[model samples]
Target: MTKLILICCLITALVIRINGHRSSIFAAAPAPSAPAAGDIVADTCKRAAAGDPDLDYNFCKSLLQSAPGSHKADLRGLAVISINLAKNNAQRVLGHIRNLIGEETNNTYRKECLKTCKEVYADAVGELKDSAKSIDSGRIHDARTALSASFDAAGTCEDSFSDGNIPSPLAADDDYYQNIGRIALSLAALLDN
Candidate 1:
């Protein structure tokens, strides 16, 4: 009976030790504190308006990294940031088109179409930036107007691309242009508070 008790005690001790080690391995690390929703929104908007694509992308990426689960607000933030980046990049591309038009020799309808696309892209970027500024300035109606302009430009670009003879990088992907339009619409809706 003494030997049986000793064996049972040894087994219990071993089991306890194993459990402790397992727990140490599987223990959840402390979660970083979430950023305030307002701060996230403000920083994102500020970066977008300031024409810092990298900063804008990082701000959105941080929001997504902090909340990888089913956070609708975070997802919306991600979508908005992405749209802002795209708009900004597209504007930069427009600048390049203007430069090309001045310097390049192959100025044709295709080149003109490309330039027009860039103009539309710049308009969208400006609208989004204005919307962000309006939000920062607490001008809700102005923000809505800016967002409407952004959507209109995006739609015009989509329709132009759909004509199917525009020799631009934008014409390569029908889905991508459609997606940009959708993002513009989504951002406008999300920002409409």
Candidate 2:
């Protein structure tokens, strides 16, 4: 009878020890504190707008605000939105170039310049489109390549006139495209995290 009691007590102690160890092993680790929703948007914009005199916090905020679900966009979403905005800008400028070409029908020199600008702008549009796609699919390297190409295209368009000692009528447009491309590129780099 004492042997039976001893065996039962041993079994109970073993069971208790096993359960305690198992509970300790399965215990959840404390989670890292998450940033507030409001802080996320502000921090994202502030980081984007930082270090560029031309880009202020308000500009970044407004840019993000123009996107759908801007309030809820995380860092990746912000990068996506920036790429989409750059694509939209490229498309708009392409149309503008076409209109400018049509308007320059009577001036041969202006017509030629506009034609060259049109070709480069088309290239820019393609790059922007590709970049947007790559970014949407989370391919940062491909997106960066496209953005680099876009920046080059804009620079090429602007330089084409300078090479010929002629003033570029599309300087403002080229600058705008380059600026947007640069901002998109910056956002793309941030996606590595």
Candidate 3:
């Protein structure tokens, strides 16, 4: 009888210890404290840059902090800002693509690649617009989907040139836009978490 009681007590103690450790392991997230002005951008950019290999921490911080109300923006606002940054970059690249196409009247193949790049940037701009609207409407999944579609433009544009064994006229632009896309996507991911 004493042995039985000892065994039960041991089992109870083990179960209690396991449950206590488990609860500690699964503790709720810490509360968000109010940070000083600009900390939100700094903090979110740091986290986003840490998570994304292509995202430059300095670039991310500068881009986010430059927004009109960045010091006051929450994660969702940062998402919006990042999307806007990418969209603006796409638009600028479109103009650069047009200029390159105009300058390359003889290289039909390079011109073709430029045209494809232009199409992709145009599509990306529209997709980014939809992404912003989706975000505004609280459709996070759709926003991410459209944002991803937009993000593909940079790589797709670069790949078109690579397939033809030609140098990409927009190589630098592609790299720039790719980093912007990574930043935007990373910030959006934070909103989900």
Best candidate, lDDT: 3
Lowest summed lDDT window (length 10), candidate 1 = 63-72
* Model 3 weakest lDDT span, ten residues long: 21-30
Give the per-residue lDDT of model 1 (tens digit) for 13-113: 68768776434333467556877545654454454434433234444444334543314345254444544654655565556557756664664665666
Segments in model 2 whose C-alpha atoms lie over 4 Å from true places: 1-39, 51-55
Clashing residue pairs for model 3: none
Ranking by lDDT: 3, 2, 1
Query: Residue 26 of candidate 3: its Cα lDDT?
Result: 38
Cα lDDT computed for each candidate against the true fold: 0.54, 0.75, 0.88
Against the true structure, candidate 1 reaches a TM-score of: 0.46
Candidate 1 lDDT score at position 28: 61
Model 1 segments more than 4 A misplaced: 1-83, 95-107, 158-167, 172-181, 191-193
Error of 2 at 144 (Å): 0.7
**How many clashing pairs in candidate 3?**
0
Query: When superposed on Cα atoms, how far off is each prediction in RMSD?
Result: 10.3, 9.6, 12.0
Best by TM-score: 3
Instruction: Give per-candidate clash totals.
Output: 0, 0, 0
Q: Model 1 Cα displacement at 118 (Å)?
A: 2.6
